[model samples]
Target chain A: MKAPVAVNGYGTIGKRVAEAIRQMPDLELKGIVKYTPDYSVLVAYRQGIPIYVPKGKEGVFEEVGVKPSGTVDELFGSVSLVVDASPGGKGAQNKRVYVERGLSALFEGGESPDVAEVSFSTLCNYRQALGKKYIRVVSCNTTALLRLICLLDRHIGVRKARAVIVRRASDPKEDKGIVNTVKLDPPSIPSHHAIDVKTVLPDLDIETVALIVPTTLMHVHVVHIQTKRSTSIDEVVETLSSTPRIVVLEGAKIGIDSTSKIVEFARDLGRKRYDIYENVVWRDMIKVNGDELTIVQAVHQEAIVIPENIDAIRAALRLAESAEETMRVTDKVLNVGLQR
Target chain B: MKAPVAVNGYGTIGKRVAEAIRQMPDLELKGIVKYTPDYSVLVAYRQGIPIYVPKGKEGVFEEVGVKPSGTVDELFGSVSLVVDASPGGKGAQNKRVYVERGLSALFEGGESPDVAEVSFSTLCNYRQALGKKYIRVVSCNTTALLRLICLLDRHIGVRKARAVIVRRASDPKEDKGIVNTVKLDPPSIPSHHAIDVKTVLPDLDIETVALIVPTTLMHVHVVHIQTKRSTSIDEVVETLSSTPRIVVLEGAKIGIDSTSKIVEFARDLGRKRYDIYENVVWRDMIKVNGDELTIVQAVHQEAIVIPENIDAIRAALRLAESAEETMRVTDKVLNVGLQR
Candidate 1:
């Protein structure tokens, strides 16, 4: 079998995937694609790995064709997997180009919903996309969400699930800290991200409400769930812990303020970056009564999609294992790093 | 019996109280206090009732030697009660002249916390201040939190609570459409307000994180709670709804923009401003497995405090009935126009 794969697109999750690939003995470094003039690109460049400057300005990255050479394009054909860490909406077709070149690929969420079966990160719903050409990482809101709902589905059947996402928008250097962008209206629940999840889980009965916060780092989600059978707090935490890519943090030292730290923390402890799980919320913040439970989760918007894109790539390639099995494998790989 | 009490500071909440007091039969037509050189003052002057202006800057009326009508002041008593709608620091006791008057008084939460024996408002622990000499009308963060906690306390026996409050800075006349002054650190929670509650309930336990947001209209509260009983969403909803001064809302609303709209929806319908008693959240947001529950409440900072100021006036007067009983009487008296 080929060694584990190298990842590209280092903005939010890209850097994270790059680090995770480093930890695995099986994965070989292929290359990284970053916008020009970024400090992170310099950091990667100093490390001596091949770094490709994707030709284009912002989204025009899409229309510009990236040709593969023995030094560049040829590598795309050999790499086991490619993760599209490029900003959402900008990397849609580039993901397909990888597929057309016969390279496995993953795309960040927020792109238009794709019909090709693809894998979602640690929640591992890859079976649905096993042997498909395209996959999308669930949105940060959805990534944080589906892992939770899937755990619920395992315990009590979920009749309906609802989430009110109080999302903080990134501080764009160009916008000068003034959020002038008008966003999702009525269907604003992660308005840009939830649509893709619906494409994957069509009948799951879900809705989202997204609000742009004035923060650049992470998205804090206030989640409420309804299950068929009555569930308890302990059961929920335990189920999540048992799942792959999900961390159930219970200590105060780990909170939304330090959510970005989870990834770095995982790295510090020598674990896979995608393995970090849930941040245990304050007890008083949750109002769980019977089958309906309410809680909050803060996700490093970038990290969630990195693993998401990785899983999406696995599905896009129609890897050897079933999608469910691939998801299981990804979860297993993520867990190995979580314990560290 | 008394002339309709004139309310000063008619911006966010001052407006709510002015309207509520207008509906009361016992309160006759005294004009509102205009904060000099503003549209609100213009509105007050046009109303045809005598308006009160402070000693500074040209108002619609001439500045006269103002003596405090003894509530807390030792000077001569003028109005039966002064709703110190003035901003937080300086109270109804304008100067030595007002202080010596011993005038009847009420203070919005901003000023001297010690001055209020019984502070009143739509939310917060009015029950604690009833019959006391000074009542503090709490800030909006306190109102939203206290109402929900009250629900949990009454129904499920709260053990410990913590809240993360996101607040809006003072409104500027220029317009709030383009503004973002968010302080992610030092997020003020209900804890500061809880200190006052603990003054009454010594054993009460809670920790709060307060954050300032860019918007000027609403205050968002993210709460974490530990309860005595494990319950379901229905029980929690029923508990929240049964409380006084709470309006519960479902997430999917069209055309509802700011917290003002949420409160206005209730006020227009003649309902409590804390119209949304419960918001639907997610399962994973629950941090730890405990007797604790997590929830969120949003409040219109101005609206919630107005009634509390009125309640404090009645409570400080040591009216025979408690604030709970008085609220009903006061609401009934003011809402009579609708019944008629």
Candidate 2:
């Protein structure tokens, strides 16, 4: 029997995570939590996914011509695991309810590090989260950073690293974005992303500065690292490309030059919501100068962490023994390499 | 007795160069070249600056109710030096005219480095440009990079540096810019900027990757450098702040966070055209870990190089013997420290 799972909060990440759960044969999407009777909830209902509302707020969904599958309390009670994909900062509060009901829960990057026993990235520390009560999946930027940094460190031993993130102001559907402005998010150095990376890869020395641009398509990262050994750009490319969910494309050769182009390429591939579920790295932009390495890549903000969230679900429930095993199952089911 | 200079091509950089030339007591603005009759010419005429039209294009200006002060040939013949502010890629074509007229010319960064005797940034290589027949003022981004890097290097001894430039798509006035996209300008690593910086600081080890974002206000740079010795952030900030055109502002403390806010602050200061001629470094964003340093700064693309252009004019005309002397005269005349 499939492990029944609940996705709390049907928002950007929650909706994507729910669909991912449904795709996995090992997991069953028991229900999704909704606080409002909005158009999104109606669409979710039309898609045949059950909706769960607050115990007293069931009337709101019924008024919108939708019946609640169960109350949020019932969601926690019925499912063995719950993915807290609520809006940022809501996960910490919802953690209390998960503990009260004796359920394993996955919190997103927005929650504090202390909210979970371990901060997780599938490639970096998936095993660290096995059978844990709570797993905090690092943010999109941090996940992207860990994936690349860890890969390089495992092969060449990264001595130190620095990154500058050109972050998108908002997701495409969100209206509140910086228009005609490049904002220094936090207006400080080593923006929260740098600190978040440490939560997963504690020994790796990394510093990051981030700025939010007006674009809503994706976040671009320029990463530099001093490695213990010398490597060629071609060698680095081969290693990074061999990994699953890391698509290395030659920008000059393929005419893929912008974040918008990456999304359109996914659209051309007929991806759902035009989501690029991989780190779209510009192959030619990876420069290796002896022991020093630099890479330029783009992370689709909406989808980069989706697979990690899926990996977290398995690790938290002890569904798989190792990260490799979990990723193999998850990757095959999601068709993660289709874009490559 | 002031050196008479003619500004070739009355466009974005040309008009500003002409006005700056007029302001410097050591230089006189003789005339400005116009390729076609446009509203800009009318404004220049209204400002009482002499407008020189192409020989056959004089009729077009007269038809537009603007009188041409002289032919382009006369403008070239009258001035001792010509500052080529024509559109990008046009500087090479105009080089023949300056040569034919036997006049010294200062080309903007858009022109190839080979077009001039040496590539110049006011602080980095001003003396190299002194009395040179043709001096190419490095691009705005390069000027900003050199200003900070050279300052830090002069004090701490830079071992190597890497920068990821979040470049503004267009000047505020230009209508053609990337919309809703973060474009890799060259779709390649070490985008021409790394090569351009090499033109001036040939021996400095530096790599740069640049992306064009949808912002017209300013270009932001995330710079990382490994110094030969350890230093504190306070020392780096103090050393960089001591420079004439470098303005270090505490972003979080001052409530200045975005490129738009930096431009707005300049406007609040009643700056001409809301131009911030300084490199606006976030005071708290400069981080130091042992010998490695990371800095986040915004370069006002439209105005950051204006002061360098003025300093180049002084250096090229042999009015100043050293970089310090040239900047001293140029900075005082233009009030370069007003933003600081």
What CAPRI grade goes to candidate 1?
A: incorrect
DockQ of each: 0.10, 0.86
Give the CA lDDT, 0 to 100, for residue B58 in model 2.
Answer: 82
lDDT of 1 by residue, A172-219 (tens): 223443242212233222344456456556677665555555555456
Candidate topping TM-score: 2
Highest lDDT against the true fold, candidate? 2
Please provide, for model 1 over B56-170, each residue's C-alpha lDDT reduced to its tens digit, 9 standing for 90 to 100: 4332344332222222211123454555566666664542333454545566666656766543444345556655544457666655566566667777788877565655555
The 10 consecutive residues of candidate 2 chain B with the worst lDDT sum are B331-340
User: What are the runs in model 2 whose C-alpha is more than 4 Å off?
Assistant: none
How many collisions per candidate?
101, 0
- Model 1 stretches astray by more than 4 angstroms: A1-10, A33-40, A52-72, A95-100, A119-121, A171-194, A251-284, A312-338, B1-76, B84-166, B169-217, B220-340
